[model samples]
Target chain A: MKSIRGLLFTALLTGLIAAVALTGMSVYLRVLHELDVVFDYQLKEVAYAATMAHPDQLLLPLPSDSASYEREARLAVQIWKGDQLVYASNPKRPIPKQRQGLTTLYLDDRQPVMGWRVYTLYSKDKMIQVSQPLEARREVGIGMAWRSVRPLIVAAGFLVVLVLVSVSYGLRGLKRVASDISSRSATSLDPIEEAGLPREVVPLVHRINDLLNHLGHAFDAQHRFIADAAHELRTPLAVIQLQAQFLERNTDEKERAEAHRQLKGGVRRASHMVGQLLALARLEPEMGGSADEHLSLDDEAGEVVFDLKPLAEANGVNLALDTDTAWMIGDPEALRALIYNLVDNAIRYTPAGGTVAVTVRPSGVNALLQVTDTGPGIPPAERERVFERFYRLPGTSAGGSGLGLAIVKSALDKLNGTIALSAGEHGNGLKVTVSLPRAGEEPTEAPESG
Target chain B: MRLLLVEDDRMFGEALQQNLRLDGFTVDWVQTAEDAEVALSTAEYAVMLLDLGLPAKSGFDLLSEIRAQNNPQPIIVITARDARRDRIRGLDYGADDYQVKPFDSDELAARIRAVARRSVGRFSSLLAHGPVTMRHDTHEVTCHGKPVTLTAKEFAILAALMEKPGAILSQASLEDRLYGWGDEVASNAVEVHIHNLRKKLGKEFIRTVRGIGYKIGDNL
Candidate 1:
């Protein structure tokens, strides 16, 4: 969109350039016109004076004597009364033709006698013709015209520069809008600010902001649906869990044992699904339920340890961690989920004797958490898709809700961070790295935690 | 020993109550946070098996209320919400332990007993299997009442093994419980502990299944 300053600048420049061209042409024509009258009158006067002097030659050039030059200045012309052309004391170049009124003719091979006005005076014996070149006349006219055109040119240049400066300032609003939008995660659909827009541009900004608001609302509704569904589903699952515990209380030996197993399986499945559902719901940015999650990954990592290594060992996989002190801004629960999911995924997919290693380091302005697993590596085509919701790679026996990586992606995105999946060390398995910015940076890195 | 089972689901609650009674826990069962509140208000329970998802109020809320009232009941929060937050939240709200759902009935009973014993200030109870016996409180071993001497590490290893006779315990778990989290576990730490244990207690007393974890002698 062209700004108002740009439009006005273009209009002014075009008008000024055209005005200059027109004024120059008109003044040049006017100069020729005025020169025609003045030179013709002088020619006639000079011819009459020379004729009155009764020159013997019919076509004589102006005399070069000092007295004649003085008389020529008084007459305001050059007198050509001799038959052969002669040099003039005035040293002004002569015209070639004896034509009446304004006429252009070649005086020399290179120069043309333009706008030369002519007249003739005839006596009984001799005819005299007087003429002057038009070059001198037009120079004065052009000089006068330039004085009028200079201000327009200066004004036009200034207008253009002012427009450029103002236009660039106006364009910064759009750039700010772009930065604001891009800084948000995939699920963040907040409206761009409409304040500080140009009067004319405000409508467009309003429309865009309105569209963002609608999108945000839609995302909110979707997330609310999931959250409500998960909440409602918990009651029945809890009922069944309690009922299972109740059944084990009443049944006899063999029946009681079988019931206990069935009950346990049901409760475990329900609990697993509930955990997955919560993680998935939290992944959506519009819900914004995780906004209050302000815990340092560095401090949390140092203090919190759940003894789940037994699960890995029981599954015939080796679990190890490379610890480092690196602080980051994130939800502590989300960080735990990220680590747990990676480690759990590794243990699930890895064959017996395989090793999984987790490393934490401080990335530039953020903390870097990496999990490397010696399992069947994810195919290149499926690597990016793995972070998507409910996207499970084909041909794996691992039973999971497929929300693990999705949650990690969402959490990292919220922290204004990034995650990358790559080939593990030595090209043997999968390595996933997540980087989250530190807290208390610019603009309060975390969402408002209330 | 008496066990108090607090659950909201009618069927599961009744079944668990019956099973605990049969397993010799003079069991008292209640449904809903209110009923559990009333039961705790009236009667003394040895150990409270609390389910987190209750009808009137949540198990976490009840646990907090119990703590707020200064009622020092040893609570084991059993719930279907196995998320890390739920476990941590329950612990923060004054639960002694957090167990995820679909747990083995026998394991639950064992945990209940262990927690009950811990509440009364006993570290471990004497475990007996046929003719073999290990005393955790006294740190001694006996075969048919004849005392057997074992090294410190060997005794520690035997105590862990005898504590859970049938269940297989992984090397990492054993190491974590024996030594703290920051302790460096040697490559042959478990092997050394097991070898020393076998020298004093008969080698057949502890069984090592190939490619899996270890279990105490089942046929002792």
Candidate 2:
């Protein structure tokens, strides 16, 4: 992992090093230039002194500071009279004679350096040259530059240390956040603490808290759903218990057989309740499984009818389905579940010899599927409430789970469909009309929960 | 005892009715608060089993209405709503007891007996008269320290008379203890049950006034 603190500290230290190196090089160059002026003056002064002593020729004395210059570099002097070498001091390597001005010379071929800076003076047919090595000046320049830049390097080092400390302090918020999150249990979806957070990190925390809010809502809904399912199953369970007791109480063969049948029915009801609950739960969180499938609603409806034909027959309800090319885009399994619940509710509510007809056709560029039952229709005041989970109509004696309409609504919402409930054609039963935009036409907007 | 069971779920109501009937309770099961109101106005009951989640009208409102009218029949709320607030609300609205659903039938029967006993100012489950003692919980009847064999209907008739020793019990009221709303009752059914009770517990065990109802044979 790339740490913010490490990255910042390294960057600051590199900048300090580069700056310090540039300062040192410029100081070295400036010192070398200044030394050239001072050394050239000394060379001129020495040349004049040599010229002043030139009348003595071969017995001329050196300059008063010549001893010190010799210790540092080999200081040499020469005099030329009428272009002939007249006087020489330490003459093994002579200073090259030049036109009367200062010049650098390579006195020997054995050395790699520019050997000397020589000053030449011409007076009254005699030339005097005073010279020194360039090596000594370079060493002094380096010492002066080092002395000047040492404190700057120390200050830069201190700055780098200070930067590292502040960088780590600035990053403390992120560390606190990581530790805070890691210490919490997975079930706690509370918002991250934002107190004392850096400004740069506040937005990120806000977005995370928003996500946590959504997760909390989803979990609450799941919990409520589970509780409601358990609560609803109890009614069927209570009936099963009673039927079992009734089975134990009856002595006659026929009565026992009847009780046994009722007991089986109760078990079947509870099992159906469980199946519907699983379907509802799966569909509750973000469009259960695959939500996009190109299929015909009429075809799915036919499959649902085929599946529920046995249940309808058992209830003595005459089931009918009229199909057409009412195509739509939806999850095939969800559509099947939606159709099954509607048909099952109709069959359960309709009395014996009653008819439940499902018709599919296109209505106004939209596919419309209708389930009409010859049973008691919902009162207009209670029509809106029938879609609530676990809401049953008053005085209706069917052993329905009260989740049928709710499941249909859930699936319809996912498919971007609309449902309308009204009285059937004869005005004595319920007609549930569901309309969805066909697959080929202009698409609908994204689904929103009802 | 006669009980009025108000529940919206049909199968649950039927199953509970069957079981309570086997427990020697004449159960009048209704699926709506409106039907319950009608049943309450027409006949009195020993106890009422109410469910809170009724369609069109909730049982909570029905309970408040029942209490407002000062109907003093013992009410036991049997519902799937197990939340504490709901339980408190049901009891506060004058229910004799609150029972969560999927409960044991035997426990429900025992509660019914206890509430009925409490309502009638009787602390004990046994109804005693002269030489006979009847245990409603166990359905046991004894006379002179010896157990007596009696059918459920015979036991019910004897219990009704012994419940209030000197009080007269109308034939119709006694029939309510033996039959539910749909049970077919012969015209001479009460007479036949009384004759058989007399034969088993001695001919003078039950006494009848010529123009009124019957009472127990002897005073306490």
Q: Evaluated on chain B only, what are the TM-scores of all the candidate structures, in order?
A: 0.57, 0.97
- Indicate which candidate wins on TM-score: 2
Give a tens-digit lDDT track for model 1, residues A1-450: 866666877786787788778877786777658755665566566667775653344235445324742243332233443455432323454544353443444456555544444454444544455554455556555765777677867877887788778778877887787788789888876677878866766788788888888988887778765654554355446546545655646556777676767576556655765787787566667667565455666555433224558777888888877777676655566677666676677777878899887777876677877778899989888888888665566544243555667777766666677788888989889888877775542245577779
Per-model TM against the reference: 0.47, 0.83
Residue lDDT tens for model 1, B90-110: 999998887776555667778
TM-score of 1: 0.47
DockQ, per-model, please?
Answer: 0.06, 0.66
Tens digits of per-residue lDDT for model 2 on A276-376? 88888766745456668778888888988998899899989999999987778887777887888888888888889999999999887799999999988
Query: What fraction of the genuine interface contacts, i.e. the true contacts, does candidate 2 reproduce?
Result: 0.84
Q: Which ten residues in a row have the lowest lDDT in candidate 2 chain A?
A: A57-66
Per-residue error (Å), model 2, residue B58 = 3.7
Task: Compute the lDDT of residue A410 as modeled in candidate 2.
Answer: 86
In terms of lDDT, the best-performing candidate is 2
